[model samples]
Target: MYFSRLTFNPLVSHQQLAQTLLQDTYREHQALWQLFDTDPNAARDFLYRQVLEQGRIKYYVLSEREPVDRSGMWLVDVPKPYDPKLVEGQRLFFTLRANPVVTVATAEGKKLRHDVVMNAKKQMGFDALPPADRLPLQQIVQDSCVPWLQARAESNGFSLEPEWVTVDGYQQHESFAKQQKRPVRYSTVDFQGILTVTDPVRFRTALFSGIGKAKAFGCGLLLVKRV
Candidate 1:
């Protein structure tokens, strides 16, 4: 796999393109798509995360093959040992930006998807009425998203230390896709945790496949480092 960072140009129009990368579901990197033998539209074998640093937009991407690029973007590829073996009981510090959501069957015999933190708040009986005083909803976000992540870890070949897991940078995102008529809405949760690997293969799978939804819109990328 190849890990890369692409820095955006400083122009306003170029910065707008950066925002397009952040919000859009269908990516437009033709060079990245060319890396595949089969149709990239069909394969879709890549993941990415975008962030801002020093007022500049940057993208971190992982793919099965190295990507090609042209002018107007500074690209760097990170080199790593090929197929490094993983073992059980190894510990690592990890960060993930994910869309944590739950699907519920409604009274109309339909299913609705909800942000996990908001769902937690509702389950805690906060939905009947609004709080009179100003409240930091993000605090409730941490409380709600932690257990959801913990449950995911349990089945994904790792276990998180209850005291070590943290959730922050909670925010909602809404966007329109070219293929869809309506807008798509979701919430993003940033999680940082120390995890112990119980199953190496499963852990690797989770690292590549990601943890939750809205991956195409910059959610569900799990980055890890050795402790």
Candidate 2:
């Protein structure tokens, strides 16, 4: 596997392209797709997280192959090979932006993935409550999304205490696809904390394969470092 950072080049003079990337998630996905288009029929096999630092747009990407930028708009960092060496009880500081959802069986026996934060709001009748009576958005995010990450950690070969993690940046993204009839929609939550590896093998898999959903639109890349 390889890890790389792609940063927009202000010297490239691509204002329109930058605007499109900033305003349209689907466009950004398509732009990133160009980096890994070794095969026209290849499926997506990478995870990315888009971030803004010092007013510059940047992307952190993990992929099975090195990313090549044919476009001049980005300054692509040299791709570094990644093979995590982990052990049981190893603790690392981590940051993950995930599309956290819970599968629920509908009354009609259909299974649907619902965004945990939105589900919590509905279950608590948040909309019905007056504005003054509503809980702070961050509190609601922490209350709902933390548990979702906790549940994911249990199965992903790591463990985290609620107090050790900070969850926020709840956001819903909506976009239109030219080839699709329905609008695309998803929610993301940011999690940052220290985690202990209970199973190094499993944790390594998670690091490569990602966690949760929406790997295409910059959602499930887990960035970590030694504490």
Best-fitting candidate, scored by lDDT:
2
The residue ranges of model 1 lying beyond 4 angstroms of the native Cα positions read 9-40, 70-74, 78-84, 127-135
Q: After superposition, how far is residue 57 of candidate 1 from its true place, in Å?
A: 1.9
Q: Which parts of model 2 are misplaced by more than 4 Å?
A: none
Error of 1 at 183 (Å): 0.9
RMSD list, candidates in order: 3.3, 1.6
Q: Which 10 consecutive positions of candidate 2 have the poorest summed lDDT?
A: 14-23
**Model 1 per-residue lDDT tens digits across residues 58-163:** 7777777765644434445553423536689999999999998888888998999989888877777776656764246877887778888888986788988869
Please state the error at residue 198 of candidate 2 in Å. Answer: 0.3
lDDT of each: 0.73, 0.87
Question: On a 0 to 100 scale, what is the lDDT of residue 57 in model 2?
Answer: 77
Best by TM-score: 2
In model 1, what are the clashing residue pairs, if there are any?
none
Reference-based lDDT, residue 224, model 2: 87
